[model samples]
Target: MADELVKAGILSAPEEIDKYYLHGSGHFIGLYTHDVGEDPDNLLQKDMMFTLEPGLYFPEEGIGIRIEDTLLVTEDGCEVLTADIPKTVVEIEAFMQS
Candidate 1:
């Protein structure tokens, strides 16, 4: 995620991002980012689903955006669940002003 953001000039470097962020939103979405699913030792078997939702918050820029996508893990590959939210600059501005 950091690599992609750096390539797009959205972030100066991966190290600029904090190591951890409080999940103030919630955790019922899926397996917590910390992988504390009541049984941390449990191994992912099959049909397990999760999310990789890291965010960047820059209060100086009045920008607090989190790019999240729910994923379905299978034996073959994975699938994105939240692919409808707009992430572009114009889209976000319109949304905020609206």
Candidate 2:
């Protein structure tokens, strides 16, 4: 995903990567924001809940963005519980105007 972001010109330098992920990528979202969970090395299983949060931060530009979604692991893939939220720039702008 970081590679894609860089390719799209959303990120300027590879050095910015560390600033974006100063904390871990994401964590379990049950009971608490950082719920108890096994190590990420464990295989994902059905019904497991987690937060998929990717961020980009540019302190020099005073810009920071983070998109987060709760996911439910399934047999084949995962389901985004926060699908209704507006993620794209157009969608977010439209939502704000409404």
Candidate 3:
């Protein structure tokens, strides 16, 4: 994401990566409601549920964009629990107009 931000000319240097982008990868979701977070050393195994959210905040431009999705790890891969919902700028705008 930092690389992409750099390519888009959002940041002049890699050192300024955290100036606007706040927050970590995401948190775990369970009966505990955010307990048992993801461990960097361990790979996500089957049955683990979590969220993936990547956001960008540009206060100077008065705009902040965030996209979040819930996922469940499976034997083959991960299942996007929020797949049914509208995402992307076009999809969201169309859904809102409807």
Candidate 4:
């Protein structure tokens, strides 16, 4: 999740989730939710990129929180691509209020 955020230019650094298990281990996202959007045998190249989403869905708790972002694999490092979406708590509150 952190990788995705940073690549999208939302965060300046990486973040560590204390409990990532309850909140989705991870996922491979793209044009399709279950299938790979890119080539099947596509390898991680110098400018490769992908999405890393970690989420927690507790229907009983009435809470379904998922953090997703697209990341670009560059020669030097990675880059985020979904910074346009509001994922922060404050941003979410503001959006809901609007």
Candidate 5:
């Protein structure tokens, strides 16, 4: 992710990547607030309920966006638990315009 940001000129260097994004891509959300799942290799497994969170913080540019999606891993794929809420840009704008 940092490499792509550098190539696109969104970030100066990989070392500064933490400055713009300050959140984990995902974390376990079962058993307690943060389960810390028993995955030693840090690999996501099946039946794991967690949050896939992505964030971008460019405070100097006045841009900050963070997305959170709670998911339940399954054999077929993952199910978004937050799907009940409208999160698309078009949906949000239309709702706001109403």
Candidate 6:
């Protein structure tokens, strides 16, 4: 993730990556915004519910992007529960204009 951002010129040094880290990629979301039971180091399994939120904070430039989606682990891949949300810039702009 950091590598991709760096390649795009959004970030400079690799060490600067920590500035955008959100203290963990994501967390379980159930009864609360941040549910419990999932371990960061453990492998994912079927039926598990969690979030995939990668955020970048370029405070100096007043730019930040954090996109989150609830996911359900499956046999093949995963299902996005928030798929209906307009996440892309163009989508967001269109939605907002409506």
Please, what are the lDDT tens digits per residue for candidate 5 over residues 1-98? 78998999988888878998887787789788777877747766678898888888998999888778899988888999998766789988888898
| Least well predicted 10-residue stretch by lDDT in candidate 6 | 21-30
User: 30-77, model 4: which lDDT tens digit per residue?
Assistant: 456544545646666665556678774545567767687877778877
Instruction: Rank by lDDT, highest first.
Output: 6, 3, 5, 2, 4, 1
Q: Write the per-residue lDDT of candidate 6 for residues 5-48, one digit (tens) a residue.
A: 78988679777799877567788877898988567779989998
**Residue pairs with clashing backbones, model 2:** none
The TM-scores, one per candidate, come to 0.53, 0.80, 0.82, 0.52, 0.68, 0.82
Estimate every model's Cα lDDT from 0 to 1.
Answer: 0.62, 0.82, 0.85, 0.64, 0.83, 0.85
Best prediction by lDDT? 6
Candidate 3, 1-98: lDDT as tens digits: 88778889988777787877888767789888766866757898999999898787888899987888999999999999999898877998999999
Q: Could you tell me which residue pairs clash in candidate 4?
A: 7-79, 7-80, 8-80, 8-81
Instruction: Between candidates 3 and 5, name the one with more favorable TM-score.
Output: 3
Reference-based lDDT, residue 33, model 4: 59
What lDDT score is found at residue 38 in candidate 5?
73
Any idea what lDDT model 2 has?
Answer: 0.82
Candidate 1 at 98: error in angstroms?
Answer: 15
lDDT of 1 at 92: 79
Clashes in predicted model 5: 0
